[model samples]
Target: MTLRHHFTRLICAFAVSACLSQVPAFAARQPGPEQDAAQQLALQAQRAQMLSRYQAERAACMHRFFVNACLDASHKQERSALAPIDVDLQAIALRARMRAAEAEMRQVQANIAAAQTGQHDSAQAERQSAARATALAQREEQAAARARQAAAGASKVAAPPPVRPETAPPAPRLFPAPAPQPAPQPALNPAQRAAQAAQAQADYAA
Candidate 1:
Protein backbone atom coordinates (compact mmCIF):
# COMPACT_ATOMS: atom_id res chain seq x y z
CA MET A 1 0.00 0.00 0.00
CA THR A 2 2.89 2.41 0.98
CA LEU A 3 4.77 1.62 -2.24
CA ARG A 4 1.62 2.33 -4.31
CA HIS A 5 1.09 5.73 -2.56
CA HIS A 6 4.75 6.78 -3.09
CA PHE A 7 4.60 5.98 -6.87
CA THR A 8 1.31 7.95 -7.16
CA ARG A 9 2.91 10.99 -5.39
CA LEU A 10 5.99 10.82 -7.69
CA ILE A 11 3.79 10.70 -10.80
CA CYS A 12 1.66 13.63 -9.63
CA ALA A 13 4.74 15.74 -8.84
CA PHE A 14 6.20 15.16 -12.34
CA ALA A 15 2.91 16.11 -14.05
CA VAL A 16 2.62 19.34 -12.01
CA SER A 17 6.27 20.28 -12.82
CA ALA A 18 5.68 19.73 -16.53
CA CYS A 19 2.56 21.89 -16.44
CA LEU A 20 4.48 24.71 -14.65
CA SER A 21 7.23 24.75 -17.31
CA GLN A 22 4.73 25.25 -20.15
CA VAL A 23 3.05 28.21 -18.33
CA PRO A 24 6.38 30.20 -18.34
CA ALA A 25 6.75 29.63 -22.08
CA PHE A 26 3.19 30.88 -22.74
CA ALA A 27 3.61 33.89 -20.43
CA ALA A 28 7.19 35.02 -21.30
CA ARG A 29 6.55 35.76 -25.03
CA GLN A 30 8.57 37.77 -27.62
CA PRO A 31 9.42 41.46 -27.26
CA GLY A 32 6.92 44.14 -28.48
CA PRO A 33 7.41 47.27 -30.77
CA GLU A 34 9.46 49.40 -28.32
CA GLN A 35 11.96 46.56 -27.80
CA ASP A 36 12.20 46.06 -31.55
CA ALA A 37 12.87 49.80 -32.04
CA ALA A 38 15.70 49.68 -29.49
CA GLN A 39 17.23 46.69 -31.26
CA GLN A 40 17.04 48.53 -34.61
CA LEU A 41 18.82 51.55 -33.16
CA ALA A 42 21.61 49.34 -31.81
CA LEU A 43 22.01 47.72 -35.23
CA GLN A 44 22.22 51.13 -36.93
CA ALA A 45 24.92 52.29 -34.52
CA GLN A 46 26.96 49.16 -35.28
CA ARG A 47 26.59 49.74 -39.03
CA ALA A 48 27.64 53.39 -38.68
CA GLN A 49 30.81 52.36 -36.86
CA MET A 50 31.64 49.91 -39.64
CA LEU A 51 31.05 52.58 -42.31
CA SER A 52 33.32 55.05 -40.52
CA ARG A 53 36.13 52.53 -40.47
CA TYR A 54 35.63 51.83 -44.20
CA GLN A 55 35.67 55.53 -45.02
CA ALA A 56 38.90 56.17 -43.08
CA GLU A 57 40.70 53.35 -44.90
CA ARG A 58 39.42 54.62 -48.28
CA ALA A 59 40.57 58.19 -47.54
CA ALA A 60 44.12 57.12 -46.61
CA CYS A 61 44.55 55.19 -49.87
CA MET A 62 43.17 58.11 -51.93
CA HIS A 63 45.50 60.61 -50.28
CA ARG A 64 48.58 58.48 -51.02
CA PHE A 65 47.50 58.18 -54.71
CA PHE A 66 46.88 61.93 -55.10
CA VAL A 67 50.28 62.83 -53.63
CA ASN A 68 52.02 60.52 -56.14
CA ALA A 69 50.14 61.89 -59.15
CA CYS A 70 50.80 65.50 -58.20
CA LEU A 71 54.52 64.85 -57.83
CA ASP A 72 54.81 63.09 -61.23
CA ALA A 73 52.90 65.80 -63.15
CA SER A 74 54.93 68.60 -61.59
CA HIS A 75 58.22 66.86 -62.56
CA LYS A 76 57.02 66.31 -66.16
CA GLN A 77 56.15 69.99 -66.55
CA GLU A 78 59.63 71.02 -65.36
CA ARG A 79 61.43 68.64 -67.76
CA SER A 80 59.58 69.82 -70.90
CA ALA A 81 60.28 73.51 -70.15
CA LEU A 82 64.10 73.06 -70.12
CA ALA A 83 64.79 71.45 -73.55
CA PRO A 84 65.48 74.45 -75.89
CA ILE A 85 68.30 76.65 -74.46
CA ASP A 86 71.92 77.32 -75.95
CA VAL A 87 75.15 75.27 -75.36
CA ASP A 88 77.19 76.39 -72.29
CA LEU A 89 74.15 77.78 -70.42
CA GLN A 90 72.21 74.97 -72.00
CA ALA A 91 74.35 72.61 -69.98
CA ILE A 92 73.68 74.76 -66.94
CA ALA A 93 69.94 74.74 -67.62
CA LEU A 94 70.09 71.01 -68.22
CA ARG A 95 72.01 70.50 -65.03
CA ALA A 96 69.56 72.63 -63.07
CA ARG A 97 66.58 70.83 -64.53
CA MET A 98 68.30 67.53 -64.03
CA ARG A 99 68.96 68.41 -60.40
CA ALA A 100 65.34 69.48 -59.91
CA ALA A 101 64.10 66.39 -61.66
CA GLU A 102 66.44 64.25 -59.66
CA ALA A 103 65.15 65.73 -56.42
CA GLU A 104 61.53 65.39 -57.50
CA MET A 105 62.13 61.94 -58.88
CA ARG A 106 63.79 60.92 -55.64
CA GLN A 107 60.72 62.09 -53.72
CA VAL A 108 58.50 60.21 -56.17
CA GLN A 109 60.81 57.25 -56.04
CA ALA A 110 60.58 57.21 -52.25
CA ASN A 111 56.80 57.36 -52.53
CA ILE A 112 56.80 54.63 -55.13
CA ALA A 113 59.21 52.60 -53.06
CA ALA A 114 56.99 52.94 -50.02
CA ALA A 115 53.92 51.97 -52.03
CA GLN A 116 55.76 49.08 -53.67
CA THR A 117 56.97 47.93 -50.29
CA GLY A 118 53.42 48.02 -48.98
CA GLN A 119 52.15 46.14 -52.01
CA HIS A 120 54.96 43.61 -51.88
CA ASP A 121 54.32 42.99 -48.21
CA SER A 122 50.60 42.64 -48.87
CA ALA A 123 51.30 40.24 -51.76
CA GLN A 124 53.76 38.21 -49.72
CA ALA A 125 51.27 37.90 -46.88
CA GLU A 126 48.56 36.93 -49.33
CA ARG A 127 50.83 34.34 -50.91
CA GLN A 128 51.71 32.87 -47.54
CA SER A 129 48.04 32.73 -46.59
CA ALA A 130 47.23 31.13 -49.93
CA ALA A 131 49.95 28.55 -49.46
CA ARG A 132 48.70 27.78 -45.95
CA ALA A 133 45.13 27.44 -47.19
CA THR A 134 46.28 25.24 -50.07
CA ALA A 135 48.21 23.01 -47.72
CA LEU A 136 45.24 22.75 -45.37
CA ALA A 137 42.93 22.04 -48.28
CA GLN A 138 45.30 19.46 -49.64
CA ARG A 139 45.53 17.82 -46.24
CA GLU A 140 41.75 17.76 -45.95
CA GLU A 141 41.44 16.42 -49.46
CA GLN A 142 44.01 13.73 -48.78
CA ALA A 143 42.24 12.86 -45.56
CA ALA A 144 38.91 12.75 -47.38
CA ALA A 145 40.46 10.65 -50.12
CA ARG A 146 41.82 8.21 -47.56
CA ALA A 147 38.51 8.21 -45.75
CA ARG A 148 36.70 7.52 -49.03
CA GLN A 149 39.12 4.69 -49.76
CA ALA A 150 38.52 3.28 -46.31
CA ALA A 151 34.80 3.67 -46.72
CA ALA A 152 34.88 1.92 -50.06
CA GLY A 153 36.74 -0.95 -48.50
CA ALA A 154 34.29 -1.11 -45.55
CA SER A 155 31.12 -0.34 -47.53
CA LYS A 156 30.42 2.95 -45.63
CA VAL A 157 31.06 6.64 -46.45
CA ALA A 158 32.64 9.34 -44.22
CA ALA A 159 32.41 13.12 -44.57
CA PRO A 160 35.49 15.26 -45.20
CA PRO A 161 36.86 17.51 -42.46
CA PRO A 162 36.31 21.27 -42.90
CA VAL A 163 39.27 23.64 -43.51
CA ARG A 164 39.36 26.92 -41.64
CA PRO A 165 40.69 30.19 -43.18
CA GLU A 166 43.70 31.82 -41.56
CA THR A 167 44.60 35.48 -41.03
CA ALA A 168 48.10 36.60 -42.07
CA PRO A 169 50.54 38.16 -39.64
CA PRO A 170 51.57 41.82 -39.88
CA ALA A 171 54.44 42.72 -42.26
CA PRO A 172 57.86 43.68 -40.94
CA ARG A 173 58.73 47.39 -40.85
CA LEU A 174 61.38 48.55 -43.43
CA PHE A 175 62.03 52.00 -42.01
CA PRO A 176 65.70 52.82 -41.52
CA ALA A 177 66.71 55.02 -38.61
CA PRO A 178 68.19 58.48 -39.32
CA ALA A 179 71.96 58.62 -39.36
CA PRO A 180 73.56 60.14 -36.26
CA GLN A 181 74.82 63.71 -36.65
CA PRO A 182 78.22 64.81 -35.34
CA ALA A 183 78.24 66.89 -32.20
CA PRO A 184 79.21 70.58 -32.45
CA GLN A 185 82.87 71.41 -31.63
CA PRO A 186 84.35 74.17 -29.39
CA ALA A 187 85.85 77.39 -30.93
CA LEU A 188 89.20 77.14 -32.79
CA ASN A 189 92.62 77.91 -31.10
CA PRO A 190 94.86 81.01 -31.82
CA ALA A 191 97.05 79.25 -34.42
CA GLN A 192 93.91 77.79 -36.14
CA ARG A 193 92.38 81.28 -36.08
CA ALA A 194 95.48 82.83 -37.71
CA ALA A 195 95.48 80.17 -40.42
CA GLN A 196 91.74 80.71 -41.09
CA ALA A 197 92.31 84.51 -41.23
CA ALA A 198 95.15 84.13 -43.75
CA GLN A 199 93.02 81.73 -45.86
CA ALA A 200 90.09 84.17 -45.77
CA GLN A 201 92.38 87.03 -46.98
CA ALA A 202 93.63 84.85 -49.84
CA ASP A 203 90.03 83.90 -50.73
CA TYR A 204 89.02 87.60 -50.64
CA ALA A 205 91.94 88.58 -52.95
CA ALA A 206 91.04 85.75 -55.37
Candidate 2:
Protein backbone atom coordinates (compact mmCIF):
# COMPACT_ATOMS: atom_id res chain seq x y z
CA MET A 1 0.00 0.00 0.00
CA THR A 2 2.86 2.45 0.72
CA LEU A 3 4.50 1.61 -2.67
CA ARG A 4 1.19 2.19 -4.45
CA HIS A 5 0.85 5.58 -2.69
CA HIS A 6 4.37 6.67 -3.81
CA PHE A 7 3.63 5.64 -7.41
CA THR A 8 0.42 7.72 -7.42
CA ARG A 9 2.26 10.85 -6.16
CA LEU A 10 4.92 10.44 -8.81
CA ILE A 11 2.22 10.20 -11.54
CA CYS A 12 0.51 13.38 -10.20
CA ALA A 13 3.80 15.33 -10.16
CA PHE A 14 4.58 14.28 -13.77
CA ALA A 15 1.11 15.30 -14.97
CA VAL A 16 1.41 18.77 -13.33
CA SER A 17 4.91 19.26 -14.84
CA ALA A 18 3.64 18.37 -18.31
CA CYS A 19 0.76 20.89 -18.02
CA LEU A 20 3.14 23.66 -16.91
CA SER A 21 5.53 22.91 -19.78
CA GLN A 22 2.61 23.38 -22.25
CA VAL A 23 2.16 26.99 -21.10
CA PRO A 24 4.48 29.65 -22.57
CA ALA A 25 7.03 30.85 -20.01
CA PHE A 26 7.52 34.24 -21.72
CA ALA A 27 4.14 35.05 -23.24
CA ALA A 28 4.95 38.78 -23.10
CA ARG A 29 8.01 38.37 -25.34
CA GLN A 30 6.22 37.71 -28.62
CA PRO A 31 8.15 38.67 -31.71
CA GLY A 32 7.46 42.18 -33.09
CA PRO A 33 7.77 43.60 -36.63
CA GLU A 34 10.98 45.46 -35.81
CA GLN A 35 12.63 42.32 -34.47
CA ASP A 36 11.59 40.30 -37.50
CA ALA A 37 12.95 42.96 -39.84
CA ALA A 38 16.20 43.05 -37.91
CA GLN A 39 16.51 39.32 -38.07
CA GLN A 40 15.91 39.32 -41.83
CA LEU A 41 18.43 42.07 -42.32
CA ALA A 42 21.05 40.13 -40.40
CA LEU A 43 20.37 37.01 -42.45
CA GLN A 44 20.64 38.95 -45.72
CA ALA A 45 23.87 40.58 -44.60
CA GLN A 46 25.36 37.18 -43.88
CA ARG A 47 24.31 35.87 -47.27
CA ALA A 48 25.83 38.91 -49.02
CA GLN A 49 29.11 38.50 -47.22
CA MET A 50 29.20 34.83 -48.16
CA LEU A 51 28.43 35.72 -51.79
CA SER A 52 31.32 38.18 -51.87
CA ARG A 53 33.69 35.53 -50.60
CA TYR A 54 32.43 33.15 -53.25
CA GLN A 55 32.97 35.77 -55.94
CA ALA A 56 36.60 36.28 -54.94
CA GLU A 57 37.17 32.56 -54.97
CA ARG A 58 35.56 32.22 -58.39
CA ALA A 59 37.69 35.02 -59.85
CA ALA A 60 40.84 33.44 -58.59
CA CYS A 61 39.81 30.07 -59.91
CA MET A 62 38.89 31.48 -63.34
CA HIS A 63 42.20 33.30 -63.56
CA ARG A 64 44.10 30.16 -62.79
CA PHE A 65 42.11 27.99 -65.16
CA PHE A 66 40.21 29.45 -68.15
CA VAL A 67 42.24 32.63 -68.62
CA ASN A 68 45.56 30.86 -69.03
CA ALA A 69 43.98 28.08 -71.01
CA CYS A 70 42.72 30.55 -73.59
CA LEU A 71 46.02 32.42 -73.72
CA ASP A 72 48.09 29.27 -74.08
CA ALA A 73 45.93 27.60 -76.63
CA SER A 74 48.88 26.93 -78.96
CA HIS A 75 50.81 25.14 -76.24
CA LYS A 76 48.96 21.82 -76.16
CA GLN A 77 51.00 20.28 -73.33
CA GLU A 78 50.54 23.30 -71.07
CA ARG A 79 46.83 23.26 -71.77
CA SER A 80 46.65 19.52 -71.03
CA ALA A 81 48.70 19.80 -67.84
CA LEU A 82 46.27 22.27 -66.32
CA ALA A 83 43.41 20.37 -64.75
CA PRO A 84 39.79 21.33 -65.25
CA ILE A 85 38.11 23.00 -62.26
CA ASP A 86 35.19 20.54 -62.46
CA VAL A 87 32.83 23.38 -61.56
CA ASP A 88 29.82 21.09 -61.87
CA LEU A 89 30.20 19.90 -58.27
CA GLN A 90 31.12 20.92 -54.71
CA ALA A 91 32.27 24.47 -53.97
CA ILE A 92 32.95 24.88 -57.71
CA ALA A 93 29.23 24.67 -58.34
CA LEU A 94 28.72 27.67 -56.11
CA ARG A 95 31.38 29.46 -58.13
CA ALA A 96 29.57 28.62 -61.33
CA ARG A 97 26.32 30.10 -59.98
CA MET A 98 28.15 33.29 -59.14
CA ARG A 99 29.67 33.38 -62.62
CA ALA A 100 26.19 33.00 -64.10
CA ALA A 101 25.02 36.00 -62.10
CA GLU A 102 28.03 38.03 -63.24
CA ALA A 103 27.36 37.06 -66.83
CA GLU A 104 23.79 38.26 -66.51
CA MET A 105 24.94 41.59 -65.13
CA ARG A 106 27.44 41.98 -67.92
CA GLN A 107 24.76 41.23 -70.51
CA VAL A 108 22.53 43.93 -69.04
CA GLN A 109 25.37 46.45 -69.11
CA ALA A 110 26.13 45.61 -72.73
CA ASN A 111 22.50 46.10 -73.69
CA ILE A 112 22.49 49.56 -72.13
CA ALA A 113 25.66 50.54 -73.93
CA ALA A 114 24.27 49.38 -77.26
CA ALA A 115 21.07 51.31 -76.73
CA GLN A 116 22.99 54.46 -75.89
CA THR A 117 25.13 54.08 -78.97
CA GLY A 118 22.06 53.71 -81.15
CA GLN A 119 20.45 56.79 -79.66
CA HIS A 120 23.56 58.86 -80.22
CA ASP A 121 23.85 57.69 -83.79
CA SER A 122 20.20 58.50 -84.46
CA ALA A 123 20.60 61.96 -83.00
CA GLN A 124 23.65 62.61 -85.13
CA ALA A 125 21.85 61.49 -88.25
CA GLU A 126 18.90 63.75 -87.49
CA ARG A 127 21.16 66.74 -87.01
CA GLN A 128 22.94 66.04 -90.28
CA SER A 129 19.64 65.75 -92.11
CA ALA A 130 18.41 69.02 -90.67
CA ALA A 131 21.62 70.77 -91.63
CA ARG A 132 21.43 69.43 -95.16
CA ALA A 133 17.86 70.58 -95.53
CA THR A 134 18.71 74.06 -94.30
CA ALA A 135 21.68 74.33 -96.65
CA LEU A 136 19.57 73.16 -99.60
CA ALA A 137 16.89 75.72 -98.84
CA GLN A 138 19.45 78.52 -98.59
CA ARG A 139 21.02 77.44 -101.87
CA GLU A 140 17.63 77.44 -103.55
CA GLU A 141 16.88 80.93 -102.28
CA GLN A 142 20.25 82.21 -103.48
CA ALA A 143 19.77 80.65 -106.90
CA ALA A 144 16.34 82.27 -107.15
CA ALA A 145 17.78 85.66 -106.30
CA ARG A 146 20.50 85.27 -108.94
CA ALA A 147 17.93 84.24 -111.55
CA ARG A 148 15.84 87.34 -110.80
CA GLN A 149 18.89 89.56 -111.13
CA ALA A 150 19.78 87.98 -114.48
CA ALA A 151 16.21 88.38 -115.79
CA ALA A 152 16.17 92.05 -114.81
CA GLY A 153 19.51 92.64 -116.57
CA ALA A 154 18.28 90.87 -119.72
CA SER A 155 15.13 93.03 -119.85
CA LYS A 156 17.15 96.27 -119.65
CA VAL A 157 19.24 95.66 -122.84
CA ALA A 158 17.22 97.38 -125.65
CA ALA A 159 17.34 96.03 -129.24
CA PRO A 160 18.71 98.40 -131.84
CA PRO A 161 16.27 99.74 -134.57
CA PRO A 162 16.55 98.04 -137.97
CA VAL A 163 19.31 99.64 -140.03
CA ARG A 164 18.16 101.67 -143.21
CA PRO A 165 21.53 101.68 -144.96
CA GLU A 166 19.97 101.02 -148.41
CA THR A 167 18.05 104.34 -148.28
CA ALA A 168 20.88 106.47 -146.78
CA PRO A 169 21.86 110.01 -148.22
CA PRO A 170 24.52 110.14 -150.93
CA ALA A 171 28.07 111.09 -149.85
CA PRO A 172 29.34 114.63 -150.66
CA ARG A 173 32.33 115.27 -152.99
CA LEU A 174 35.69 115.89 -151.19
CA PHE A 175 37.07 118.50 -153.70
CA PRO A 176 37.27 122.20 -152.73
CA ALA A 177 35.59 125.06 -154.72
CA PRO A 178 37.73 126.52 -157.58
CA ALA A 179 38.98 130.14 -157.15
CA PRO A 180 38.75 132.91 -159.94
CA GLN A 181 41.71 132.64 -162.30
CA PRO A 182 43.82 135.72 -163.10
CA ALA A 183 44.01 136.94 -166.76
CA PRO A 184 46.71 135.06 -168.67
CA GLN A 185 49.97 137.04 -168.86
CA PRO A 186 50.53 138.28 -172.45
CA ALA A 187 54.15 139.41 -173.01
CA LEU A 188 53.80 142.21 -170.46
CA ASN A 189 55.69 143.32 -167.33
CA PRO A 190 58.30 140.65 -166.38
CA ALA A 191 57.47 140.84 -162.67
CA GLN A 192 53.78 140.21 -163.28
CA ARG A 193 54.55 137.41 -165.78
CA ALA A 194 56.90 135.62 -163.33
CA ALA A 195 54.31 135.81 -160.58
CA GLN A 196 51.69 134.37 -162.85
CA ALA A 197 54.06 131.55 -163.90
CA ALA A 198 54.76 130.64 -160.24
CA GLN A 199 50.99 130.56 -159.46
CA ALA A 200 50.38 128.32 -162.52
CA GLN A 201 53.13 125.90 -161.23
CA ALA A 202 51.55 125.73 -157.78
CA ASP A 203 48.11 125.04 -159.26
CA TYR A 204 49.48 122.31 -161.51
CA ALA A 205 51.18 120.68 -158.43
CA ALA A 206 47.91 120.76 -156.49
Candidate 3:
Protein backbone atom coordinates (compact mmCIF):
# COMPACT_ATOMS: atom_id res chain seq x y z
CA MET A 1 0.00 0.00 0.00
CA THR A 2 1.08 3.61 -0.56
CA LEU A 3 2.27 5.77 2.38
CA ARG A 4 -0.85 7.92 2.00
CA HIS A 5 -3.07 4.82 2.24
CA HIS A 6 -1.21 3.68 5.37
CA PHE A 7 -1.55 7.12 6.95
CA THR A 8 -5.24 7.14 6.22
CA ARG A 9 -5.76 3.73 7.82
CA LEU A 10 -3.83 4.92 10.90
CA ILE A 11 -6.13 7.93 11.21
CA CYS A 12 -9.22 5.66 10.92
CA ALA A 13 -7.92 3.34 13.65
CA PHE A 14 -7.26 6.33 15.92
CA ALA A 15 -10.73 7.67 15.27
CA VAL A 16 -12.34 4.34 16.11
CA SER A 17 -10.28 4.09 19.34
CA ALA A 18 -11.31 7.64 20.33
CA CYS A 19 -14.95 6.90 19.73
CA LEU A 20 -14.75 3.67 21.79
CA SER A 21 -13.07 5.56 24.64
CA GLN A 22 -15.97 8.05 24.69
CA VAL A 23 -18.55 5.21 25.21
CA PRO A 24 -19.87 4.95 28.77
CA ALA A 25 -18.49 2.19 30.97
CA PHE A 26 -20.57 -0.87 31.77
CA ALA A 27 -23.69 0.19 33.66
CA ALA A 28 -24.21 -0.81 37.27
CA ARG A 29 -27.63 -2.28 36.52
CA GLN A 30 -27.55 -5.22 34.17
CA PRO A 31 -29.14 -4.72 30.74
CA GLY A 32 -32.59 -6.16 30.20
CA PRO A 33 -33.24 -8.76 27.52
CA GLU A 34 -34.60 -6.24 25.07
CA GLN A 35 -31.61 -3.91 25.45
CA ASP A 36 -29.20 -6.83 25.11
CA ALA A 37 -30.94 -7.98 21.94
CA ALA A 38 -30.87 -4.57 20.40
CA GLN A 39 -27.19 -4.03 21.23
CA GLN A 40 -26.33 -7.44 19.85
CA LEU A 41 -28.14 -6.75 16.61
CA ALA A 42 -26.35 -3.44 16.16
CA LEU A 43 -23.00 -5.01 16.95
CA GLN A 44 -23.68 -7.85 14.51
CA ALA A 45 -24.46 -5.36 11.80
CA GLN A 46 -21.20 -3.52 12.45
CA ARG A 47 -19.31 -6.82 12.37
CA ALA A 48 -20.93 -7.73 9.04
CA GLN A 49 -19.88 -4.38 7.66
CA MET A 50 -16.33 -4.89 8.87
CA LEU A 51 -16.26 -8.42 7.36
CA SER A 52 -17.47 -7.17 3.98
CA ARG A 53 -14.88 -4.43 4.02
CA TYR A 54 -12.17 -6.96 4.90
CA GLN A 55 -13.23 -9.25 2.06
CA ALA A 56 -13.02 -6.39 -0.45
CA GLU A 57 -9.62 -5.45 0.91
CA ARG A 58 -8.49 -9.08 0.64
CA ALA A 59 -9.52 -9.28 -3.03
CA ALA A 60 -7.77 -6.01 -3.72
CA CYS A 61 -4.64 -7.23 -1.89
CA MET A 62 -4.43 -10.36 -4.09
CA HIS A 63 -3.76 -8.11 -7.12
CA ARG A 64 -1.04 -6.09 -5.32
CA PHE A 65 2.77 -6.64 -5.43
CA PHE A 66 2.99 -7.02 -1.60
CA VAL A 67 -0.08 -9.29 -1.18
CA ASN A 68 0.90 -10.82 2.20
CA ALA A 69 1.49 -7.42 3.78
CA CYS A 70 -1.74 -6.07 2.39
CA LEU A 71 -3.74 -9.03 3.65
CA ASP A 72 -2.13 -8.75 7.11
CA ALA A 73 -2.98 -5.07 7.36
CA SER A 74 -6.57 -5.76 6.31
CA HIS A 75 -6.94 -8.55 8.85
CA LYS A 76 -5.54 -6.32 11.59
CA GLN A 77 -8.00 -3.55 10.70
CA GLU A 78 -10.88 -6.03 10.80
CA ARG A 79 -9.87 -7.24 14.24
CA SER A 80 -9.44 -3.70 15.56
CA ALA A 81 -12.90 -2.72 14.30
CA LEU A 82 -14.60 -5.73 15.87
CA ALA A 83 -12.75 -5.57 19.28
CA PRO A 84 -15.28 -3.25 21.06
CA ILE A 85 -18.28 -5.25 19.88
CA ASP A 86 -16.68 -8.47 21.12
CA VAL A 87 -16.04 -6.83 24.51
CA ASP A 88 -19.66 -5.67 24.78
CA LEU A 89 -20.93 -9.14 23.86
CA GLN A 90 -18.64 -10.74 26.50
CA ALA A 91 -19.82 -8.31 29.17
CA ILE A 92 -23.46 -9.03 28.41
CA ALA A 93 -22.92 -12.80 28.53
CA LEU A 94 -20.97 -12.57 31.79
CA ARG A 95 -23.73 -10.55 33.45
CA ALA A 96 -26.35 -13.06 32.36
CA ARG A 97 -24.32 -15.95 33.77
CA MET A 98 -23.75 -14.15 37.07
CA ARG A 99 -27.44 -13.41 37.38
CA ALA A 100 -28.26 -17.06 36.77
CA ALA A 101 -25.78 -18.16 39.41
CA GLU A 102 -27.27 -15.75 41.95
CA ALA A 103 -30.79 -17.03 41.29
CA GLU A 104 -29.65 -20.62 41.69
CA MET A 105 -27.95 -19.77 44.96
CA ARG A 106 -31.10 -18.18 46.33
CA GLN A 107 -33.11 -21.28 45.40
CA VAL A 108 -30.61 -23.52 47.16
CA GLN A 109 -30.75 -21.42 50.29
CA ALA A 110 -34.56 -21.54 50.29
CA ASN A 111 -34.51 -25.32 49.98
CA ILE A 112 -32.07 -25.63 52.87
CA ALA A 113 -34.24 -23.40 55.05
CA ALA A 114 -37.31 -25.50 54.25
CA ALA A 115 -35.52 -28.70 55.16
CA GLN A 116 -34.38 -27.23 58.47
CA THR A 117 -37.92 -26.13 59.25
CA GLY A 118 -39.23 -29.63 58.58
CA GLN A 119 -36.61 -31.15 60.88
CA HIS A 120 -37.45 -28.68 63.62
CA ASP A 121 -41.15 -29.46 63.36
CA SER A 122 -40.45 -33.17 63.50
CA ALA A 123 -38.27 -32.73 66.57
CA GLN A 124 -40.95 -30.69 68.28
CA ALA A 125 -43.56 -33.36 67.56
CA GLU A 126 -41.32 -36.04 69.00
CA ARG A 127 -40.81 -34.04 72.17
CA GLN A 128 -44.55 -33.58 72.59
CA SER A 129 -45.18 -37.28 72.10
CA ALA A 130 -42.58 -38.15 74.70
CA ALA A 131 -44.11 -35.76 77.19
CA ARG A 132 -47.56 -37.22 76.66
CA ALA A 133 -46.24 -40.72 77.12
CA THR A 134 -44.56 -39.73 80.36
CA ALA A 135 -47.74 -38.17 81.66
CA LEU A 136 -49.79 -41.23 80.76
CA ALA A 137 -47.33 -43.52 82.50
CA GLN A 138 -47.48 -41.44 85.66
CA ARG A 139 -51.30 -41.56 85.67
CA GLU A 140 -51.31 -45.30 85.18
CA GLU A 141 -48.90 -45.78 88.08
CA GLN A 142 -51.10 -43.63 90.32
CA ALA A 143 -54.19 -45.60 89.33
CA ALA A 144 -52.47 -48.90 90.03
CA ALA A 145 -51.36 -47.68 93.45
CA ARG A 146 -54.89 -46.55 94.29
CA ALA A 147 -56.31 -49.93 93.21
CA ARG A 148 -53.86 -51.75 95.49
CA GLN A 149 -54.81 -49.56 98.45
CA ALA A 150 -58.53 -50.07 97.83
CA ALA A 151 -58.05 -53.85 97.65
CA ALA A 152 -56.18 -53.80 100.97
CA GLY A 153 -58.95 -51.76 102.63
CA ALA A 154 -61.63 -54.12 101.30
CA SER A 155 -59.81 -57.16 102.72
CA LYS A 156 -59.51 -55.51 106.12
CA VAL A 157 -63.24 -54.70 106.18
CA ALA A 158 -64.29 -58.24 105.12
CA ALA A 159 -62.19 -60.16 107.75
CA PRO A 160 -64.02 -61.58 110.85
CA PRO A 161 -63.32 -60.10 114.32
CA PRO A 162 -61.27 -62.13 116.83
CA VAL A 163 -63.24 -64.31 119.32
CA ARG A 164 -62.66 -64.22 123.21
CA PRO A 165 -63.09 -67.14 125.66
CA GLU A 166 -65.52 -66.61 128.69
CA THR A 167 -65.39 -68.26 132.26
CA ALA A 168 -68.78 -69.03 134.05
CA PRO A 169 -69.50 -69.49 137.86
CA PRO A 170 -70.58 -73.09 139.01
CA ALA A 171 -74.33 -73.64 139.30
CA PRO A 172 -75.81 -73.72 142.85
CA ARG A 173 -76.43 -77.37 144.29
CA LEU A 174 -80.14 -78.45 144.05
CA PHE A 175 -80.05 -80.75 147.29
CA PRO A 176 -77.70 -82.09 150.06
CA ALA A 177 -75.30 -84.90 149.14
CA PRO A 178 -76.42 -88.68 149.89
CA ALA A 179 -74.38 -91.31 151.95
CA PRO A 180 -72.49 -94.02 150.11
CA GLN A 181 -74.12 -97.58 149.60
CA PRO A 182 -72.37 -101.02 149.44
CA ALA A 183 -72.65 -103.30 146.44
CA PRO A 184 -74.87 -106.54 146.83
CA GLN A 185 -73.01 -109.95 146.96
CA PRO A 186 -73.72 -113.06 144.71
CA ALA A 187 -76.06 -115.89 146.01
CA LEU A 188 -74.34 -118.98 147.63
CA ASN A 189 -74.41 -122.56 146.14
CA PRO A 190 -76.31 -125.60 147.85
CA ALA A 191 -73.15 -126.97 149.48
CA GLN A 192 -72.30 -123.56 150.88
CA ARG A 193 -75.87 -123.46 152.38
CA ALA A 194 -75.63 -126.98 153.94
CA ALA A 195 -72.29 -126.08 155.50
CA GLN A 196 -73.69 -122.95 156.94
CA ALA A 197 -76.71 -124.99 158.45
CA ALA A 198 -74.37 -127.58 160.10
CA GLN A 199 -72.23 -124.72 161.51
CA ALA A 200 -75.42 -123.29 163.00
CA GLN A 201 -76.50 -126.77 164.55
CA ALA A 202 -73.07 -127.22 166.09
CA ASP A 203 -73.19 -123.82 167.69
CA TYR A 204 -76.65 -124.79 169.20
CA ALA A 205 -75.33 -128.09 170.73
CA ALA A 206 -72.47 -126.22 172.32
Q: Which candidate is the best by TM-score?
A: 3
Ten residues in a row with the worst lDDT in model 3?
17-26
Query: What is the C-alpha lDDT profile of model 3 across 1-206, one tens digit per residue?
Result: 44455445555545544544444553445677778778888888888888898999999999999999999999998899889888888766655555555555555555666767989999999999999999999999999999999999999999998787776788987996787777776798999999989999999999
The sequence of per-residue lDDT tens digits that candidate 1 reaches over residues 149-175 is 887977543546568788788899889
Computed on alpha carbons, the lDDT of every model, listed in order, comes to 0.59, 0.57, 0.77
TM-score of each: 0.22, 0.34, 0.54
Question: In model 3, where do residues sit more than 4 Å from their true spots?
Answer: 1-27, 41-49, 146-206
lDDT of 3 at 37: 75
Please give, for residues 176-205, the per-residue lDDT of candidate 2 as tens digits: 878989989677698988998999999999
Query: Which numbered prediction scores highest in lDDT against the true structure?
Result: 3
Regions of model 2 farther than 4 Å from truth? 1-88, 158-206
For candidate 2, what is the TM-score? 0.34
lDDT of 3 at 24: 57
